[model samples]
Target: MARRNEALLRWFRQTGWTQRELARAVTRLGQARGYNVAPDSSRVRRWLEGERPRQPVPELLAALFSERLGRPVGPEDLGLGSGAPPGGELGWDQRGLVTALQDFTRSDLMIKRRDVLGTTAALATGAVLENRLRGWLDPVRADAAPAASAGRIGTAEIAEIEAATRTFWTWDAKVGGGLYREAVVGQLKAMTDLLEHAYPEQIGRRLFRSTADLARLAGWMSHDVGLQGTAQRYFTFALHCAKRAGDQRLGVEVLSRMARQMVHVGKPREALSLVALARRGAGARIAEAEQAMLGTCEAWAWAALGDAGRVDRAVGTAQERFSRAVAGDAPSWLGYFDQAGLSGMAGLSYRTLAEGDPGLAGRAEPHIDAALRLRNRDAYARSNLFDLISLLGVRIVQGEHAEAERMVRRVLPVTGRISSTRTVDRIRPLARRARADAARSTDAARLAESLDGLLAV
Candidate 1:
């Protein structure tokens, strides 16, 4: 005989439905969903005896329980299967994806799962990339009902969330991820709570779009702080939210950001594939600025892969497209991809190219300088700092040891104020290089000592 499912038994009892009545309910639910499922009282008995229901049935049961409980539910809640895929896995079905994000965000906020939050693992295989792309391409389902709850949500609340998201975004840009990670998480929790409340369909869509933007920003901040696993989960959830909002462009944006993360983590090939997926999703009708942003991302990936020709072509395309972009033509989320953002990415791409060909420093320096000059130091401190460090690295590679040392000294004091581990990691290489060259120059020796002191913090 099969073992009983105690969790299912408890939920069934709490629901107060006879096995036959539950069967009838499942049948009606399936009919309403246009699925041919017809579980009977006997089927319910088998489930009670721990026979796992198949795909659509488990999803339907979760939905039923969620409706009755006035909260989102999942297969794992009923002890039906191993817990849904971790939130970082972006290829799950709509309901499973939403439920996974809810659990992951809660766990991240509580700091209960350090291992999950701290990992830097990459899981962007071709199959996974294709799966996510297919999901993004799918039309939004029309049958999803507005969430049910005792309280009503309005557009004003959504406006507040949007304003808050913008505030956190600006803070992250200026103060770095370490300063705003907790605040972003708190905002996400509030948005998730709002999602649980009843609202009109139009308001619900707006809420989801805003939430998607916030989730993407949270992922970016997480990446900035070197919490790659946490970042991946946030990006996946942002994609889910964009899909729910029927915003393909936002989904494409999330994919681009994920591609950027992949490149940073040394998975350039995977990054290239992800960028391709984003382009495919955007198709021919995307705005020029969005096209330019995607092109720059592609250039970054190609530069990482050491494809100089492709990088040049891609960067040129990005620049040409950006020149055609008018103010307010792109979406609000794409606002960051203006001239300075493009210059920063171009500088990064050139820096990557210079790694294999030191003579390329001449080509890279102007872009890096332009990025620094174009960015507002107060509003975009972290990015400006990063560009400065990149330029320092390029100078060091060009054998301008004394100049590089002075630049490092000038920036050393600011690093203490910024909380990003990534910034420190980027600076460490220059310190090591300076140390290695100390025997050749007294300035190098002194700079190395100062850098060591800076790194000690």
Candidate 2:
């Protein structure tokens, strides 16, 4: 049998197309390009299962994704190209960065278009991003020079954008990304437009840093609402902005978020690679809290791999670093990862750890409870909901039928109020484990049904 064509499948799902829809869209695209080809659901299925289309079809597919992804998407990206192309999709220069940002905010890029650009995101591989960092670590003088356009902007405007980013972040944590993604994108578009003008050296760096912060927020919110590919694209460009700002810490933080995305997609080894690169790039004297955050990320990756020893060491390192954290030692960007954040991350690691070994359920509960207790009722309510589900997952694993039932009964009703894809993702596995065990009680069966209803999976 042919290989399963995971590359094509990954992009296909990222496109959020039903087999029939993809078939119809590609067929129409081919016709528009003057190729009289007929493709249906079966044809799409074959492509997904490792069958390459005849000449011109793969090219059409590439064209479709290139337009949809806002970046170059070749046949290689979809597993239909020849000659064993390197496993990455990263080739954008400084000039190309503006084009990428502009493509993201196109008015024509609506959800119901030929492909959902913002609503569904394609995954970016770790190799692709780390490759970009090669340029970031060392910058050229020409790239750093002030814009040649008629000079105008200053520090005041940069301050406003930075404040707006912080505000949006707070909103994202309180409300889900689905509610305000368009607003974030719109602001991001306006911010990108400002780059056309000129500012002095200090103001220019500040502007780029502010833009980087906003772009990362846009990416985070995109990921929040299930737009994985869009998130990656935003993050890739945010890295571009961070580099332009000459801000090493921000770049490391962006990589950390990318690592989180990897973990979410079950690519923990990739996640580990990203975190490792981030630490190595930061060098020896990273701030205490940032060090803790990075360590927690490492522990989470270790937990995903079921490496208990490594997980313990990483978490221990994180906690130790967190204790020594001094006021103002971290940058303003570090505000989000406070005591509550560290506790929640530690809990999440153990919860992921419990996935591979249910006996570790006890290890996860206390930290999650601490997170639940410490998280601000208004600012981090959405996260609190996620932690509640973490609690439920741990309970289910520990064989607490009645308690789990009570918890889900309460949570099931409230979850609909939240609108993050991460929440949906959290429910997915808990729903699976609840239904899989025949030994589970009626309460467990009902809980699974509720979760399935929420997910419709």
Clashing pairs in 1: none
The lDDT, on a scale of 0 to 1, for candidate 2 is 0.76
**What is the RMSD of candidate 1?**
9.9
User: Can you write out model 1's per-residue Cα lDDT over 1-457, one digit (the tens) per residue?
Assistant: 7678776776677668899988998999899989999999999999988787887787677666655543333455566643443222333454554555555555456443233333464343567556645667667765533345644667786788889889888888888888888788778877776676556668877888998998998899888877775687688789888888878799889999999988887888888887787778768767899989999899989988888899899999999999998887788878777788999999889888877788877777888889988988888888888898889889877888778778877788778888787787777777888898899988788878877877887
Maximum-lDDT candidate: 1
Give all TM-scores, in the order shown: 0.78, 0.79
Give the per-residue lDDT digits (tens) of candidate 2, residues 1-457.
7666777787777677799988888889888889898899998898888777886887777667666554445564566654322332433344445544554554313333234433433464656556655565565345432246854667776777778888888888887887887788788888777776667768777877888888898888878876777677778778878877878799889988988887887888988888887777678757999999999989988998999999889989999999999999898888878888888888999998998899998999889989988888578878788888888889888877668777877776667777787888888888788888635478778767767787762
Worst 10 residues of 2 by lDDT: 83-92
lDDT of 2 at 250: 92
* Candidate 1 segments exceeding 4 Å error: 1-94, 112-118, 122-126, 439-443
